[model samples]
Target: MAGPLPDGDQAPVDGLLSLEEIKGSEARTFHAYVHIPFCKDICGYCDFNTYTATQLGSLKQSDYAASLISEIRFSAQALEQSKLLPRKFSTVFFGGGTPSLLPAADLIEILSSLEQTFGFTENAEITTEANPDTVTFEKFAALRQAGFNRVSIGMQSGVQSVLDTLERSHNPENVFKAFEIVKGLGFGTSLDLIFGAPGESLEQWRESLEAAIALEPDHLSAYSLIVEPGTKLARQIKSGELAEPDEDLQAEKYELTEQLLSAAGYTWYEISNWSKSESLQSDHNLAYWMGQDWWGYGPGAHSHLGSVRWWNQKHPLSYSKKLEDKISPAVGRELLSIDTAKLERVMLESRTSKGMSISDLEQLEAGAKSRIPQLIADGLIDGQLAIKGRLVLTLRGRLLADAVVRELTD
Candidate 1:
């Protein structure tokens, strides 16, 4: 289970957007995110909106696809009624508790509904996040046939002990097999790694990184483990049954990650993501960082269009009931003020390789502009890039990214 949803203005039942809220949407890239909130077993460290079979009393997993399709059609009607121009989706991403838990046919059906409603752009990127154990060769093949071009496998750790500590359900060996299946089907493959587990060692982290690299994945994301409040992992640490992650050790591991991945020919495009080349970057994720419009369908999913952002009901049952009644599942929404939107743009873009423009910062706050020279002097930003009008982070800056954002925003 996740934390409570943020407070905001109540969303309209018809799901209609104001013309002012959607103005200029035609000029922005559009995307779709389908959230699958089912999981075979909830991981101890996860705080995402997810539910196991036991937790969902009356919600049948078999009926989930149909519910999502209803939302898709409803979204189209809402946008049309709002008088927003129809735009093809440039990317579609299926993320969840474990998207691979659903039957491939269900995924295909939901995707077909999306295509039938708004269509897709030429060369559109479609991706899904899969747990290694839940996927098979036939599954990947079927998805490929249905037009999914990318797959991100959850390969949290190569070491059995680390996986055990995280309470991951997949066998370590299954990751390589899943990767082989997806790659053989001509899908762009990505592997996810997590470091800084409660008891993880530098050597164990190295082994995980090496294992992912050996597969020669097109893209990789290395994330530090965060034990959110109310999660099982957090409880264990609170009870002193498990040691908390050491920030110093995590910093050391990050530096090791940069060193090894760079040596293996991967370039960091964002603070936590790397790719073999620019073409292999995760465009769907980049859309979020770049502030493009995307409609998120499914329980607990969040969507952003122009200046407005909204999230659906968190529980699957609550989400489905609203759709069944021909209402938007969105419980609340917020219209971002100009200052809020600009600050967000700075906060997100500053973490990417295509760093924030210096002029934009100056416009946001003159003090932010003054902080640039101090940032460069402290080895937190690339001096040459600053001279060239962008605030690109140095390696050290990436490790202290939140601090960098504070300096600029303050």
Candidate 2:
């Protein structure tokens, strides 16, 4: 199960974003993240805040678009109340419980709401997450007309048995079919592949990567599977019906990923994320890793600006009721302290190809900074980049990213 929602009232408005944070001298990249909390099927390995259409009692799809737009309007009003000028959104991403499950018109209506309230950057990237089985070329065309330039397809595996084990319904061929359609329609396409699935072999993982690379997607995100507590997959493992994922095996697979993708000319911009080039990297996700501002809309969405981070109410019914009652649906928030912020910058930036600056590393305890030389000696941190004044990671470093973060922060 997902962890308990934080306990607190909606945070104070003044705590949302300071006038300075909102109107900084330097223009910050702004992003909009729209979450669609409904999916047609719930995969066994999953634990996201989502529901199927039938499970969503009283939350009519007909009323969903308007209610979502209303929330966007409320957000804009709040910014106005704080006397901050809203810039054009740098990127807009419609993530889901299967965003493609909604009609094309619904996606457009949400995009239109953003345009009316915040405008879009002239070269803004607009993307929607689509399950390979749920999208069509005609729908792609409608989405293009509605100004979406990218579609990220979930292609969990190329092996049928792997899909079955994960309880994913889409045929592997459907992934290539969706990719071809998106490319044919002149849209930027990204494929998300998961590795380290229970019962998955190293060879199966390689085949899945090769199949995805064969399609020549603009971007690729290879993530290791995490079995969340209370998920069907976790229970299966607990009951001995499924094998637990092997950590050492996953580390080997991660190295294999760097080799294969880098060989194909994909730049590893961030751990777990690669692109044909920097231009093809996900701008919306970069905004997050780079610690910029973004407002996430819809149930269970999270938003952040400067030090304040907050999330919306998790359930769609509760989310809708709050919006209908003209209230902020934010369930809780926390203000990041300066020390915590510095640590976060190091943690996020160090995982990227750009890495963190040398002087910035000096911000940590001397004992932590001293470990860099040893890290480089162990083939973890890149010695070349360290000499050039940045903390770029080696392929080995990425596999042990959590350990690196712990050494540097704790």
Best by TM-score: 1
Instruction: Give the Cα-based TM-score of candidate 1 against the true structure.
Output: 0.99
lDDT of 1 by residue, 1-410 (tens): 25778899999999999989997687899999999999999999999999999999988999999999999999999999999989999999999989999999999999999998999999999999999998898988999999999999999999999999999998779998899999999999999999999999999999999999999999999999988999999999999999999999999999999999999999999999999999999999999999999999998899999789999999999999999999999999999998898879888999999898889779876778788888899999999999999889999999999999988877
Weakest 10 consecutive residues of candidate 2 by summed lDDT: 8-17
How well does each candidate superpose onto the true structure, as a TM-score? 0.99, 0.96
lDDT of model number 1:
0.94
User: How would you encode candidate 2's per-residue C-alpha lDDT over 1-410 as one tens digit per residue?
Assistant: 14456664457633345665554413678899998988888999888888987899878866778878978998998877777676689999999788998888888989998999999988899999999988898898999988999999999898999999988889888998889999999999999999988889999999999999999999999999999888889999999999999999999889888889999999899999999988999999999998888889988888877567788888888888888888887888876677877888888888899998877778654566677898898888999989998899888889888888888777
Query: Which segments of candidate 2 are over 4 A away from where they belong?
Result: 1-3, 13-26, 364-367
Clash pairs detected, candidate 2: 1-229
